[model samples]
Target: MDTIPAILRAAAERYGDQPAYVEGARAVSFAELHDQVRELARRYVGHGLAAGEPVVVWGPNSIEWVIAALATTYAGGTLVPANSRYTGHEVADLVDRTGATVVMVADGFLGRSQVQELRAASDLPSVRAMGELSRLSLDHRGEERHVREVTIDEVEARADAVSPDDVADILFTSGTTGRPKGAMSAHRQSIGVARAWAELGGVSADDRYLVVNPFFHSFGYKIGILVGLLTGATLYPVATFDVDQTMQLIESERITLLPGAPTIYQSLLTAPGRAERDLSSLRLAVTGAAVVPVVLIERMRDELAIDHVVTAFGMTEAVVVTMCRDGDSAETVATTCGRAIPGMETRIDAPAGEAGELLVRGDYVMLGYLDDPAATAEAIDADGWLHTGDVGVLDDEGNLRITDRLKDMYISGGFNVYPAEVEQALMRMDGIQDVAVVGVPDERMGEVGKAYVVGTASADEVIAFARQRLANFKVPRLVETVEALPRNLSGKVLKNELRK
Candidate 1:
């Protein structure tokens, strides 16, 4: 499909009665999805929201969140999804940055009212809770045509007014170093990546997708929701990724497809009474963000009975650059993020066999950072390559091994040390459940690796374990065991936080 609105229309016509999304006790069919989106779009129009305006959809996983997203697009507005886990200050920053005209937030999530939080943080207009909107929609029910007089043809016409090049979304990047910049993507680019990802994963109508990724992430909103629509797979949105609840959902829902970060599958593998649950229906799986243990991949297949376990690499600016294919070996799946998606091209800026910055250019590349011309120019050069601030190497077979973030690499004893490489080595260490390595200040070697692990291990023991497999320069000087590592909504460890 060309646009999200187009996908809605197409799915409504093709899979009219098939279930589209299921959240808790609520389930919506493809036809109902379209009707709800259309009705909501009319309400948005009735409220005087114009085309190309920005609307903030701030909430966790729910059918209403999905409807707000699609309705925003159908109303010819750009959807700016806010991370529900954000504090008031963070949410205020996004609302101010995006200049969102309307805020549709979940009421009292985590015992805090999102609308109250937004109001407390900033002076925003048209803030309405989801329950308020539901009541309003109910009050305006038979008067849908009379209130706005917007017919289905008129809604379609409004959706048709949105061009392929129009900015459909402004996804804020995880602000690890500085403030998060809004990465703007046109309808075509946003839809293109999801379509490619679905094809890469072999998503089919028969599949049932369990989306544990938060709705604010590109992985969840685009790949999870959009791919489900594209492939006609039933979507089950998990508001939280609790191991017990997630396993129960897979068993109860007969989930067939699940894709999340490495931590997700790792937790599922180690969950108590995991084998007692019936996860045999799981067929396709994808994980990334951290190094995937080879044994973990093997166990997922053998123990969980999952058929295809794929690994992929991408970012907010560009989605799905590389992905492991269906029949790739376990080592291949664990070690390398397989070749680029169909039409995307990736090249390392440094010498061959050496890790360097990875650059990508394709239809999937974003339009640019919203309202920041200088930053946009710095990110995407005149040659059209989007300079991904990541260090990686491409093997002869075209598979990509991401060493670390370019900013995460440090020079030690005149040699570069990538934390991801060191972290990968530490992941194989016995008694270590998860690991994050960061370069820390050192008096002699200029810099040294400091590892934060999620298991019981003494610093000396962990250093010895690393010394066995990694070079002297790569071995972590200090290993701190913690209950858990700090991570963002997408399951990426916050190394900056760790450095603190």
Candidate 2:
């Protein structure tokens, strides 16, 4: 499909009554999903969302989130998804950066009224409309004002106006600069990457896909949601990954396709009473976002009885870059993120068999970072190569093994945590003279943050202070008081020493 709206229309015609999305007690057929998206798009148009404008969707995974995200694109508006784990300050910064006109949040989710928090964080003068995602309808009065009902014809007109080159979503990813950058992807690129992933995984209409990744992430939104849309796979979105709840869903829903970080499969393998859960319906398991052990890959196939188990490597800039193919050996799947997919090219700056910065150029690469030309130029060179900021080695067979990162970022529970951002937040606290953060290996999480401080505050006090400011995954799990951090002659803190 050329665009997301086009995919929605085609899915309705192709899949007809086949189930598209199933959440708890509710399910929507492909046809029904198309109708719902159109209805919601009409409401968005009635609410004064203009073409090319950005709408921020900040919430957990649910059928409502699906509809709202799809409706935002269907209404000719760019989708800007915010991390649900973000505090009001984080969300406000994103909203301000995007100049979002409509901000839809999942109120009362996890016992917090997100809209109120966002309002309390900022005056939000640019936000002309705000509402709870669950209560988004033409007749429902939003926090700011009521929506003006518009006809389906108007919605169709807007959808027809959308081009493949139009920016579909602007996903924010933090950098070493301690600031988040919005990566803009066109409708074609989003659908293109999803289609590529779906083809590689052999996703089909009969497959029941269980999505455990957060919808705000590229893993969930692009590979999970869009892949399902392209392949007609019925999606089962899990708002949170509880072992018992996921196992119950797998048994009840007869889930066939499951993709998540390595930790998810590890949990399922070790959860109490896993054998009794009737997990025979699981056919495919795709995992990444953290190191995947060869033993874990074998266990997922042998213990869980999943027929197809694979691994991939991707980022927010380019959703699915390299992925292990079917029938790949366990070692290959575990140690390497297979060769580049179709429409993409991969190369290392170093000689063959040596590890260097990985570079990629592809049609599915993001358009650019939103409103940041200098940063965009630095990332994607004039030759169209996007410097991935990752150190990797390519073997004779062209398989890529990631070794290290040029950026001081780590993955905690599959979430990208930038140490610079954590250090920036901690420096704001009183009596904190200086700080340095690094990722330490963990048994449960792939990596957790550790902070080395040069200040008078106790470890517990610093941890408590961080809890109120940073997201849970970004918070340092361990703290150490040091007289000073080792620095280079150039006055730069040597992060390698801290990592050691």
Candidate 3:
């Protein structure tokens, strides 16, 4: 009950014969997954790695991804999952920052990108490919079998001797700053988050989940994977986010639950044969990351036909605070981030209709930013409330409305301009897929607005469109058309990288 391993134990007892995980054509049962983790723990302990040391789970979403994670935790080590979409140097910078003791990457990860980083990494740790580990399926095939030279008896013997509360994972923050910050999470934190999500989402064993998002993100780990496990539900993992592929998988898998950015939902609306497909099985669709526009939410309501589209707002610091509740209004669902979840407190420094920096405090807030006391002090106040850098306003009912990001706001000619406002206006233009607005230095204006747009329209056309919607001062002075926007693994826009 205190850890995820306990839930694994429960599944082995009540649902051992049930299908626990299915990857493409391969399926592993409850007992099968538990046994696999047990052996994985032995393999890690067999190596010289000790508790609290870091082991990187670097790969596309796979059964092995979960296995490596569980095994690392079961062996009492910290797991660090690398973002598969990131460049090698990007990945190396993260690993180097965490100072991992060992890294588990898929074969040919280096060949995929210039992230030949881990190999050239100075003061590097041990590395392993998937097949190199002698751990087997821990299958109960009615007869004893050997996994390489090792037996199931050997694996179980090693697992039975371990303890919980050993550092389970060192989840490094998506490094917006040059150096990534590692958040040391325990087995208890995983369980706590999953439990909190179950209450927030009302998830159950009957729910069938479809997750296209990567597990490294807080939403995927806490809600997609962790909540699914807690509810005894079946989870369908899509390694990558392909709008067309997800549409088909939803029907094929009979998906009932989903949690991802509004981008996924936006893209799904355009999937071919979208209206032709039978998608009646879906019940819950949770979106986070960027704010959900009312138009997108309306299209989802009238088009995709999913009624209960819940939106929750949170960060790695505060687990999850605001979530639009059941029977909440479309305007509320689309605009106002709903009332605070149980055990969470929310406040706005400005008047009800005015914007202010959002503050959240709860049992789920992270202990502190790992090793950076100054940043920890700056982020979390003496009262223990985490000051989320997000800028938003509180409505009469205490629901929060996020207008723009504090960091993304800029000053132009002594006038304040929020890039989110400009980006939102540009996104409404025809053929526009995405748009990002930033501020660059201007001798006269201090900072001038610049827009990077991704769409079929030319720079002049976009500028023309923006000129009509915004004031002359607010209109972007520079427009660069790009194929796409740079985003982090969680689908959050990497504005820091975009600025560079």
Best candidate according to TM-score? 2
- lDDT of model number 1: 0.81
Candidate 2 lDDT over 1-500, as tens digits, reads 58899999999999999999999898899999999899888878887889999989999999889999999999999999999888888999999989988888998888887877887888877776776788764333347666677999989989999999999999999999999999999999999999999998899999999989999999899988898889999999888889999999999989999899898998999999997889999999988888788999999989999999988888999998999999999999999999899999899999877899999999988999999999999999999999999999998888989999999899999899999999999999997899999999999999999999999999998999898778789999999999999999998899899988
**What root-mean-square deviation over C-alphas does model 2 reach?**
1.6
**Candidate 3: RMSD over Cα atoms?**
10.8
Candidate 3, superposed: residue stretches over 4 Å from native: 109-117, 123-166, 174-177, 351-353, 409-500
TM-score of each candidate? Answer: 0.80, 0.97, 0.75
**lDDT by residue for model 1 over 1-500, one digit each (tens)?**
58889988898898999999988887899999999899888877766567988888777887888988899999899999877666565677777887776667676776766666666777754332122333324222222333345667777889988888889999986423335688999998888999999998889889999988878888899998889778899999887668999999999999999888766777788899997999999999998766667998999999989999999988888967899999999999999999999868999999989999999988888888888898889899999999988889999999999887756766554344667767766777778899888888774455678899898777888999776555466678887889999999999998889888
- Which residue pairs come into collision in candidate 3? 88-115
What would the per-residue lDDT of candidate 3 be over residues 38-101, giving only the tens digit for each residue?
Answer: 7776666555445666777666666777777777665656777766555454466666666665
Tell me the number of clashing residue pairs for each predicted model.
0, 0, 1
Best by lDDT: 2
